[model samples]
Each structure stands twice: as structure tokens, then as C-alpha cells.
Target: MAKSVNQATQAKAKADAVGQARALAPEVPARIGSTPATKFRGNPEIFGRLVEDHDKHRALLAMIEATAPNDPARKALFEEFVRDVHGHAAAEEQALWSTVMRNPETTEFARHAVGDHHKLDKLMADAAARDITSPGWLTHFATLKDEYLEHILEEETEQFLEAEKVLSEADQRYMRKVFERRKKAEKAAAVIEKKIALKPVA
Candidate 1:
């Protein structure tokens, strides 16, 4: 009787240990932090989605800018869109694109993105510095719009789809989440910017 009790206790202990180990083990690759480079790297498909969403934002900006700046509501909306665009681009540059550039597989795509980034940087700076109502503002905005769409098309057709081949299913899912989160963040930033623009400056 004593021996049997000891055996049962030992078996229970072993089962509990196994359960604990399993609990501590990493889950499937679908989760955001499952891999290192995935969490920090740019997946072109995801970036393309980001661009699509951004284009919608640009459209909104153009609409609001077309209105009188004294129209508090339109002005606010425009400011919000600008803030969102700035935040999204800044985050991608800092986290995704920067890391991807280091990998040999992504080198050429990264270089192209970097060059596109330079053009975008100038466009953004020029737009931000100008009087939103200036005659040249629309032309500049239109030029930026064309370049933006072209870059996005290149990423979608060539870079992003190509990169997908190199990633695991889990990493791919993570990329989806990252892109979704970025979209949400940009939208939120736009709202906040609009709110701020509504307030009378002290």
C-alpha cells in the first residue's frame, strides 16, 4: 500500500512538471513577438496596405486644404491627417525599414525604399513649411501624390510579394498585425491632431 501511494504521487508530480513546461514554451509563430526580425522588419505586402491607407489620408488632406483655413472643422481634419502620416512614416523608418536594410535578401528593396523615403521626406517638409493656401501648394501636393502612388505600386508588385516567400507563416501573420496596428495608430493620430487644431492657440 505504501509503495503504491508513493508511485501515484511521483506520477502526479511528473504530469504537473510536463504541464508547466508546456505552459512556458513558445506558442505558434502567429503572435507578434514570435520572431525577432519579423517584429522589426518590413513586409512589403503590409507596407503596400499601409500605402493604400495613406493615400486615403492624402485625399482627405487635399479636401480639407481646398477649404478655407478659417473653416475650423476642415482645418482640424487636415491637421489630423498630417499628424497621422508623419507618425506612420516615422515609425516605419525607425523600426521596419531600418532593420530590413541590413539583411542581404532585402538589400536592394531597402535601398529603393530609402531613396523613396528621401523624396517623401522632402515632400513632407516642403508641404509642412508652406502656407496651405499657396498657389504652388496644390501642384506640390499633386506631385507628391503621384510619387507616393508609384512607390506603393512598386512595393506591392515587386518588393512586398517577393519578401513574403522568405517568411514563415507565423511571421506573415505577425506582419499583418503590425500593419493593422500601424493603420489604427495613424488614424488615432489624425483624430488627435484634428482636436488640437480646433482649439484656439493661447
Candidate 2:
């Protein structure tokens, strides 16, 4: 009888602890596969998504650079970087820049940003064509890195500010959703493109 009472008391204590935890937990929105909450300036949904991708790209670039030329890790990292950038740029153009282009105040900014994406794409292609062990490939990659850094800086600072002025909070939220969906499609397309590129010429 004593052992039964002790078990009951322990069960009650465990239930109370769970209740306390639930009470203390912060309320979060119920969304499927949600990214981290935005801590950056501007609309949480819009800039937040872009910032997350930017952070990822930055880390990948650093990791790729740290690897030795001709190393398998370097090759793998570069391939991943190319796919990520391709998907991100295409999706950004479709989701964010397209909306920014609609406003006269932001049209020029969007155009310039899109142009930067094109330049980076070309640089990436040039680097990919070179022998991975050769100095030329590293040089081309370094240039691409420098240019990409500059482009994202301008984007996060200037372009985003101009875009915010023109886009309402509701619009930003909607674009975030569109960006997420389009990015997934673009990433899949990037994979297909990579596979085609790898196929031997017959």
C-alpha cells in the first residue's frame, strides 16, 4: 500500500512539472517546416528568409575556401555552393526582385541586383570550367567571392531598404511564402541541370 502511494505521488509530481513547462513555454506560430524566427532588421518574414540563405552561402564559401585545391571535399563543397547559389538567385529574382521591380522607386535597384546575379553566374561558370587543381580556378573563385560579397552587402543594406519602403508588411509576408516555394522548385531544377552537365558528350 505504501509503495502504491509513493508511485502515485511521483506521478503527480511528474504531471505538475510538465504543466509548469507548458505554462512557461513561449507561444510560437504553427507553421510547417518553419525557419528560425527573424532577428534582423525589416520585415521578419521577408528579410529573414534572405538573411538565412545569405548566412548559409557565407558559411559554404568559407568552408570551400578552407579545403585544399583538388580535394574531394573542395569539389563537393563547390558543387553544393553552385547549386545553392543558382537556386537562390533564380528564386530571389522570381520572388523578391520581381515584386521590387513593380515599383518605380525600386525598379532600378531590382535591375541592378539582377545584373549582379548574372555576373556572379558567369564567374561561377568560368571557375567551373577550369581544372580544380589549377591556380586559374582558385583565382577565378577568389574574384567570384569578392564580387558576391559586395553584391550581398549592397542588397542587404540598400536594396532591402528601398524595397521595404515600397512593400507593405502583408506583401512582404506573402513574398516570403512565394520565395520559399519557388526556392524549393529552383533547387530541384538546379539538381537536374547539374546531372545534365555531368553527362559525357557522346
Candidate-wise lDDT, in order: 0.49, 0.65
Candidate 2: tens digits of C-alpha lDDT, residues 64-160: 5665675666676677678878888898999899989988888999999999987777777766776777755676678777788778778876787
* Candidate 1 ranges with C-alpha deviation above 4 Å: 1-52, 61-78, 93-99, 178-202
| Model 2 stretches with alpha carbons more than 4 Å out | 1-43, 191-202
Clashes of 1: 1
- How well does candidate 1 match the true structure, expressed as C-alpha RMSD? 18.4
Q: What tens digits encode model 1's per-residue C-alpha lDDT throughout 90-199?
A: 55554456556677898788688667766665665555555565555566556655676566566646665555555555554555567567756754654221111222
Please give the lDDT score at residue 185 for candidate 2: 89
